[model samples]
Target: MHRRHFLLGGAAVMLLPVPAVADAAPRATLYKNPQCSCCEGYADYLRRNGFAVEVKPTNDLAEISRKAGVPEDLEGCHTTFIGRYVIDGHVPIDVVRKLLAEKPAIAGITLPGMPAGSPGMVGDKTEKFVIYAVTKDGKAPSVYATV
Candidate 1:
C-alpha cells in the first residue's frame, strides 16, 4: 500500500515477460501458385495483422478455388481458408477482420484477380476494391463490401 512499494511493483510487472495468447491470432491456411511472390507478401501481411497464416504453394490452386466454390474466372491469385470461410485474393485486412467478425452465412469472400495496390500486390490502386461473397449452394456471388 506504500507509494514506493506500489511504484516498484508496477515497474517489476512491466519488466516481466508477456506470454503469447493461446490461439489469439486466427489461423488461416493460404494456398497459392508456387511461382507467385506476391502471395508470400500477402501471407506476411496477414501475419503482421494478427493472422497466423500458413502458406502452402501448390499448382492446383485453380482446382482448390473451384472446389471451394470460387468461380473459375473470379478466382483470386491465392486462396485462404480461415475457420469456415474462404478468403480469396489480396483482400484488405479490415475486410477480412469484418468477415471473420460477422460470420455471414456464405462460403467466403473474394477480391477477384490480382488488383494493383491490393494488400500485397504492387502498383498504385487504380480503383476501389469490390469484394464478393460466394455461397456453397451454387448461387451467383453478391457484392459484400467495397473498400
Candidate 2:
C-alpha cells in the first residue's frame, strides 16, 4: 500500500505544469553608415548571441548617434538600441547580457572607438578597451566596464 501511494505521488508530481522560462534575449535596432562593413559584422555577432537585430543603414550615423544620446567622445561606428538602453560601438556580448540582467538606470553603454579586438573589429586585443555608461541626463560618461 505504501509503495502504491508513493508511485501515485510521483505520477502526480510529474503531471504538474512546468513553469515557462522568460526569454532573456532582447531585440535590437542597429544604426550604421551604409558603407561600414564592421557594423554589419557587429550585427551578425548580436544575431549569433540570440538577439534579433534589425540593421538600419543610414547616411547620417552621427545624427542618429546624437539623437540617441550618445556622447560625442564616446561615439562608435555603429549604434544599437536594445530595450530602453543604447549600446554604442562594438560592445561584447557578455557585457550586453550583464547590462540587461542588471537593468541599471543609465541611458546606455558605449565602447567608444573601434578597438582592434572588439566584437566587430578583427585582430588581437592589443590594448584594454573601456566601456562607458552614459547617464540619463546625457551628461559626462563614466567607465562602466573594461575589456
Candidate 3:
C-alpha cells in the first residue's frame, strides 16, 4: 500500500470507536421503591453517565438486597446490579464505571447509608467517603474508592 494511504487508514482506525473500550459503560439494574425521589435521581445520574439503567420499583428492599447477596451492614437506600457487581446507595458514576472496567473479584461496591455527600444525596457540602468492596463471605469490606 502507498505510504500516504497507509497513514490515512491508520488514522481512521485510531478514530474508530471500540465497543469493549474501558470508556464504554455497562448496563445496570437498579432496585428501589417507587416513591423514592432520591433513588430516581440516582438513576438519572447513572443514565447521564451512559449507563443503561433498568429500574425496578418495589417496597421490598430487604428482599431485593437479600436475594442479591448484599450484606446487612452495607445496605443502602437503592441497590443496583451491574453485571456481577452490586452497587449500593448513591455511588458516583465514575467509580461504578471503574468497577465494571476493572471487573474486580469482589461481590460488589457499597456506600452504606444515604450519605449527605453521595451523588444523589448531595447536601450542603461534599463530604469525603469510601465505597467498600464487600467480599462474598460478608466480612469487613475493603476500600474500593474514596470520594
TM-score of each: 0.85, 0.81, 0.76
- Candidate 3: tens digits of C-alpha lDDT, residues 1-147: 699999999999999977774336667899998888899889988888888788999888878776666677778889999888888888887888888889988888888888886777758545677788886675677888987
Using TM-score as the yardstick, the better of models 1 and 3 is: 1
Runs with alpha carbons beyond 4 Å of true place in candidate 3:
1-25
lDDT of 3 at 17: 75
lDDT of 2 by residue, 78-143 (tens): 999999999999999989988998999888899988999899899999988899888758477888
lDDT of 1 by residue, 1-147 (tens): 699999999999999988688468889999999999999999999999988889999999999988888898789999999999999999999999999899999999999999999999999999999999998799999999999
> What is the alpha-carbon lDDT for the whole of candidate 2?
0.88
Task: Give the range where candidate 2 is weakest over 10 consecutive residues by summed lDDT.
Answer: 17-26
Shift of residue 69 alpha carbon in model 2, Å: 1.7
For each candidate, what is the lDDT? Answer: 0.93, 0.88, 0.82
Tell me which residue pairs clash in candidate 3. Answer: none
Best-fitting candidate, scored by TM-score = 1
Top-lDDT candidate index = 1
Provide the lDDT at 20 for model 3: 75
